[model samples]
Target: MVTLKHDSHEHELNLTEVDAYMVGKGKCGVCEMQINEASSIYKCLREDCPNNSLSLFFFLHKSCAELPKQITHPHHPQHSLVLGREYNQEIVKLTRGSLPHLTACKLCSRQIDEQMWNYFCKACSYEFLLPTNAYLHIFTFSLCIRCAIMEPAIHHEGHKHHRLTLLRRQLSLICDACGITKENDFCYSCLPCQFWIHSSCAASPATIKLRFHQDDTLHLIYSVPHMYRSFTRHCQICKNEVLKDKWAYFCEDSGYFVHITCARTLLAYGENEIKHEAEEEEEDYAQPHPDLLQFPLPSTDSLVANLLAYHQLKNPSTITNPIAEEPVIQHWSHEHHPLVLSEKSTFKGDADSDDDENDDILICNGCTTPILNQHKYYQCIRCNYFLHISCANHLPIKFPAGKCLADPDHSLNLDKLEIKLGRNLSIAFCHSCHLPTNGFGYRCNSCSKLTDIICCLLPDKIKHDSHKHALVQHFNHPSFKMYQNICTACLAPVLDGFDYRCETCIDVQIHQHCAMLYPKSITHRFDSHTISLLYPPIYYKGIKYCEICELQVNPEAWLYWCRHCDQCFHPNCIRAWHNMKLGDKIFNGGIHRHKLTLVAIDKDRYPQRIHKSLACNQGHDNGSSLDVYLECAGCFFIL
Candidate 1:
């Protein structure tokens, strides 16, 4: 194809005619449609063009009929180029394997057909012509995409306060148009003269127009009441179909900035680069062009084709799609849903549903799936997670809540148990872990675990990796307050809600434990016994040596008492005491604190007659609360 130099210094002329070889039939260089439809598609007469394909028009996806026909070429002397067909074949064969010989068009080269060319070669003194072959020689100004998309952009110029750019692009470029770096179509100027712009930059008017080119391209632009933007096809740069809502570009040359983007991206764009970046960034350049015309176009060939396709597809709602049902309030008519109660409610529905469809549907008491199965069913009002009697009976919910439910391991049904003390006096266990749960609660029938009424609202079958079996609340007794001093098994504090629980198997293990829990290794290197708790309140009587804290535990305060070793100790000191299992390694030294060793005492070594201090009454007095206050028992802190 006849091509132009990459230089921005040389202006491009859309040459009118050229010689081209008709190698074969192919898609139109301009429309991308096959040439058999030539009656409908116009052909560019430039030589070197690959059958009137898209590249000749800078890959414009629009119609060739709309393209401007007048243009100017920098290298050629032609001032008025007119559009026309190309050379005949007689001169083409002589230039094979060599550049074609052509003359500059009588009119501007920009107005020439892109697929044909008219040329001249001074060296060979030859002229090539392939007239009937309409698809070969492309226009001299036509550029390949590798060099087409770069845009006219400006930066501070030599004056440091100015900017300049060639209105035309020279080649591919780099910029953060969308903030993406690898490759993005953007506006930029050629490096030296810097005349460049992107399809996007060409679309954005304030960013698009340069002050330097304003005089040549725009007379004035401004907004009239509420009319800040204008969506004119001639000024728009972006290829997206959506029209701008508020902002609009105005140009005096074409009469509108709406086509500004279109004008700039146009290969033969007639304007130059804007001179000031700040001015280019400003929107108040020119006042509204008083003659604003809104043109209404009848649908065209492309629009009709796309619209027809869209209407042919089936609506999504009418099609079959998988439905995922979420859990909701459900109930069984029987014991299965022990807590399920029947109730009526409303529901939210999509627009298509009738007003009556807003009413609630029957749901299962357990899984909560819609249940058309039974006429009468129970529903859990709280969690919305309910089950049918068959399932609920199979699952069994706890009755009364009591201390047993408070245990983490065991569940309880306190309602079955008779209320012993008044509300404050009786400790009801939760149905979850079965430790006697305080306050009101419901328990799962199995697992002997206690659960608070609020906690019960959780989905059935809570699982803990720490527990071997997935736990459920015990449903046997409604309210049972078994122990108060300690959690029966662990002997830890019996806090608010715990389960006084038991596991079934002809054999079972239950231990009262503390509410303040730290993770316990179910398997301990210390013993075959899983570490168990001893309520410190009961274990620390008078003064007891704490296996953990090692200090004598106070008889009153709450502490972690271990049943494994059967000692009350500070919870924090368990590991410390464990570290000192050997009696030889006593932490508190008796040196100043008197390190006591069992040494043989020789009473004979003391003078039998020496009763000097013995003269001072030396005796033991058991009634005083003195600790070393009087080393001589004779005084025994009597005062």
Candidate 2:
């Protein structure tokens, strides 16, 4: 017999060592696990204790009875946590008011009863003097008895190369095994390779037999095979694009791929699924020939043969069949005259001159970009039209149905319009970038949506300087509906359009154009120094305001800042300055405007006028006046 003073109970527990079967069937009070027969257990001999009743008596496994009164957990190393029942009033106050669950273990994410034994950080509950809401940012760490004693390092079957160490704190990262981002949760990590996974994800079975794919078992793989990298594939269960670099379960025979998180739901029903055998050698998959043309070409035999002949001429070593004519192809943009291939400058007066002239900066009609002389381009001698060799060979005449995300039901034909001074400019904005352009684009006849060539060729995955991880393009997938639909760059709501989201960061979702088109650094007119884009958690002395708009800028959101000048500006403000060039005309019918020309004005010079305008604008009352406004170039009037 041993006398022990337990912190949870007032009476002294008289424990006696005996086999669990001798004490009859009972559960351990601390660990709450069944006391197996013949196992050594410390049975409480007290009969009148509150922890005992007529029907049941307090009992503990030998290990549970030997647990220490205090322990130093890795998650909260600052102070020693006390082992006790869930009777901390401070935790009850903090959790009852804000947290959705009554009491949850931070490690296992399981709900614990009030009478259950747990390890809690006592310092967190008594440190604050104010209302619980004010210090809600502080997390009260709590762990169940089972999780508190977990091993610090573990070896998972998924990653056989090295042992994974338990992380002390939760971080914003995606699990490499399951491809899911569970925010603010502890995970196992291999620091060298930056591999991370949830505790549950790390314990996933090596093989699973999904009900949908009954014929063959799906084997876990570290990554998609190299042969399947060229082809885009979606998850067999969720229908979302499967990340090629993340861990997934693959069926080699059927090419069926599923995310680990998506497949784990069916593992409970599948029996005899664990396969300890070595992974079979991957079979060689034949690589498909690369398609040069993204869209369909003209069905006419002559046009098709001419285009194929041009390809053959470009690569003589690859093509054996020879065409007996010069590759003069009829392009869709300039169908009136056949364009002849030219290696040298074709401008009438500058044919022999190698000097770079202003005419050398001729833009291609197909893509609306400058045409370089180094690369071979097809030019029309009868007209001033020119097409790059790549544009002529690959630019599709018309995108097939369901190709465009904006209007999937209809096909979009390639269209181009020249912007002239007198001609009425039908300004069409690219659906992807939302930037106005008169260049060549694919226009849907049914919806009249135009997508620029630059946006149409954007890859499925991109690396941006704003984020540390590669961003995957999403088209309003259901999996992302849990996150806030807002762009991290511009702080604007992401509507029904394409967005690039970082798989690691749960809050990082950027607009397609903002992710791809936004420049990292820009020279703003407001400041002489170059302004670079900045991420969240900006530390400044005072309230930060945009230099251009003179408005408070959210330091938590992305903004452009100049370190030399100690100035910041909103992304939209800088973009507005760049988009609106000097001498640009704006027509506002409400305001008296005979086409207002954009001009920079010094507010300091017209102090009296500003004072008078402010007084007049506020009906003879003192009020703040605008710092910047457009001045009419015609009559020198401020509008």
Candidate 3:
């Protein structure tokens, strides 16, 4: 029996049978890769196989064929899983379109390409989509490539009784194994003893190359029982107590013991030796029985690829001709047939009302927003698909040439989105704007992490409608007070990845999407008159206040200010107010005459309505009356 753990869950597997076999063209069932005819192969010979018991048995590479007797996977620690080589008929039958269940490559989060051969576990249906070039480190390591690469378990000499498993969350506790007090969010823990150790301590090497005493080799000491306690014992490096029952490196010949923490600092000092050893090793060959700590650290590119490969299906490539001719008939977001370019308006508009909806209701499917004013748009009559000229003209076929705010050093390229399966969701959302789309954007080359089209194309400086001077694109502010950076427009913490900072003004920062807000003017439900854009440095009375939110507005942030009434509104509040539909009701008010309904103010119909403030029974103790009252049609009272 073999147990494989995935997504913090355990799965049990059984190897029914094995035999020498051959398969042509298709990928191996165990590795999800093409098998070279010249290479040795094996097949499952079980009469009643778990994988559908199909007429044609599943095949595996010689390296992938070997199965362990009984295994306990970190993901599934409760029970052991047995490796099964049979092809799962249940998953194969759904090969017509897509599986009803959303399945991803267990090793990487990348969606399993439909109908492709993969290593599948019957218990969890956890699949592995392997790269054809991947080869085993050695037959000695029984774990699959995915499990081997991701958060692999470690056998430290300090905790010889159990293997310490790598965990992602922070555990604030004194390490039982090392007896060291450290503040790290990530650490390795022994599930059985609840013993935790810092990741750095877990990764400590077997031997330390000392700076002070080069002649002596400091070997790591694992067992430090309470019986070995002595008052005179002290770390040679830190001069601190080498606590009993704590592991440390000791040079017995030199009569010195160094704490594990002290030994880790020597890593930087011994970097030259580390590099020299790595250089001496054969490029393609590794030692058959290398020390647990001796494996070469993965490169930056490899680490990034490990993450990005989870979702990306296609091979990443640069876009040679970015400004290619717009397809006359094509698919932008929809995927039925090619959407033909047409000028006819497909939007159904209200005929009688001269409202803003009549003007801005025609939405572009690409940006998934209303087409403002006379911007030329393309529409498909049959499918009712539409696209803005700007989105259509600048549609990226692949990732674009731009610097990511996340990783500024590496130039990002665009790629088509490979939407994850099992999510009852449509449309790819931009991390910046939070809008749905099917356009191409920049992907981080190192990690394959994606950035939306709108964010990738932002200029270094933007001349926004609300600002007089251009707001510069900046990383986190050096003087940010909160743990997380905040956006000035919404007066909320900027939890999203990046922000646009106004260099001209102090502490003037907004999200990139907020800076690119369109429509210079808008009529908010909170106010009667149309609100105009106002940038930072909004000089006013003692303190400016926003009537919509009834909160104090930061004098140095962009606002939708009305000069006539001296009213101010946060940019986000204005957008939220504009998107609300009529007939909307609110439950809470100062005094409840009726639920506040969203109705147009008709001055002509309600001629006798007084402008004077009304005193409510629910008024505050200070005799404050409800201001700006409106008549509720249902209750026939001021609300």
Candidate 4:
């Protein structure tokens, strides 16, 4: 019991020392809590005090009337937590931690904004902001409502049959809701069901609409047992096996299925990353479109099925070689006609070669390898196509299945020949690189109609220091109208062969090998600093001229641009002035009779037979300020 005077009157009151139950329930005025119990209390002897309302009395607990000098929190191992008030701006600095922006609450996984007053721990770097009064309830369960979702078990919309148990230790299990192997420290598991899900995957949405399969909506299937168990499932988008034990999406009516990660990938990338099916189907395919060079190659199975059936009906003979004894057969690359085996001793050079038969010189058209009189070869006399013995037997007819350099999403298949009266088109050229070849060719079902074999076999990724972005190989850009295919680098027609194109920038194309040939560093006589290759020379307000040749260099063309010297040299000029040594023999194209040897001119002693300067038929001037000229030894014709 205690007594105190209030309003000049003496009164008696009851008071007792605080206990655990009392400490837990007593309301405090300062912290506005029903718990904290460190500060002393006094009871008034009088029944009431001035400014009292609703029988309420002034009470203090811990630092209610005053302020907490410091506080120690388990979450913060280093710095002491301190109370902050409106007036004590200096003491207000003792917050738990700081959050620069609105971030997710660790307990609830809900977003918390920066406007709220926060407690900061400098040592542990913990940020504790009172999001709402509800967060205080977390102290009882030793977790958040979100964390409590995994306590004994949690029922997610993704998984309805059984509740998922919280897995606190590192899990070696793979997530059933997504096909990714789990290496995470924590996840949810159904031990009896042998199913696991990532905490992230558990938070996935119920339904999704993917770009690839836009016609239908997909419903999430939480476990393999919940999926269509009657048939083996494969992802339609990625064409990969969907494990029966994994989570995936399925459209019941359409039978469309996709991987969880693949769907997320499309959603994350948005429409730009999606391959437009409508755009690919927009081609006005000619009836009986047998022009193998056309965009979008004809179906391989149909063409090959017809060709093989026709070949079987036409020729059934099995010719076996007596020596080495391998079956001599007709190959698809050579018109499906019988190619008689010719041994090294029987090779009579090439019929078209100007060299005498005894000269022992020939070239195999297949590999472009020189065939000496001693090497065995295969030749089609009717077509004049020669191939090395090995090339004829083992050359690939189609590219392997994968996303080609030309089209990122489409899988490439070889172009199938349409046999017309026992012969396929021999003059066929690769639509991408315009190079004529009777070798393996490729086409993508997704984007391209046809592509050259050489271009399809190119490495999918290449690194070049001059290029800022990793240039991806594109077979043929559909954006270009017919006859409008142009290489921005050389400013020439790029109807054939693939271009290493920038995925980020449209209209940026580089020749595959040309881009790879850019030098990392180069020393020039005119420039003091070592210059490096620049894929695209920076275009100033005015046109940039090549420092070496003085010709206006196309900004898109590769240049050896020096940052220190601020000079740009065309790639051709770099090779001509820096790489080419004096006395190098080179051809001057159709205007010369023989190869010309490069020579420096003695300005005073000009040859009588040679003109001072001459221009080629194409109107390109031969005169250069740096190097003199190449002249014919026989006629002294200046080239």
Most accurate candidate by lDDT = 2
Q: How well does each candidate superpose onto the true structure, as a TM-score?
A: 0.22, 0.34, 0.33, 0.27
Better of 1 and 4 by TM-score: 4
lDDT of 4 by residue, 274-328 (tens): 3432245445222333321111112111222222233334333312112232446
lDDT of the candidates, in the order given: 0.30, 0.58, 0.47, 0.46
In model 4, the runs with Cα more than 4 Å from the true position are 1-152, 155-163, 168-172, 181-186, 203-206, 209-215, 222-241, 262-292, 295-639
lDDT of 2 by residue, 508-538 (tens): 8988656643356666446789778776534
RMSD of each: 32.2, 22.1, 29.8, 27.2
TM-score of candidate 3 relative to the true fold: 0.33
lDDT of 1: 0.30
| lDDT of each residue in 155-234, candidate 3, tens digit only | 87778899988775555678764786665435778888887887666655566444333444556776543323422356
Query: Which parts of model 1 have CA positions greater than 4 angstroms off?
Result: 1-72, 77-125, 129-164, 167-169, 175-187, 190-196, 199-343, 346-365, 368-377, 380-385, 388-639
If both were scored by TM-score, which would come out higher, candidate 2 or candidate 3?
2
lDDT minimum window of 10 residues, candidate 2: 293-302
Checking candidate 2 for backbone clashes, the offending pairs are none
Better of 1 and 3 by TM-score: 3
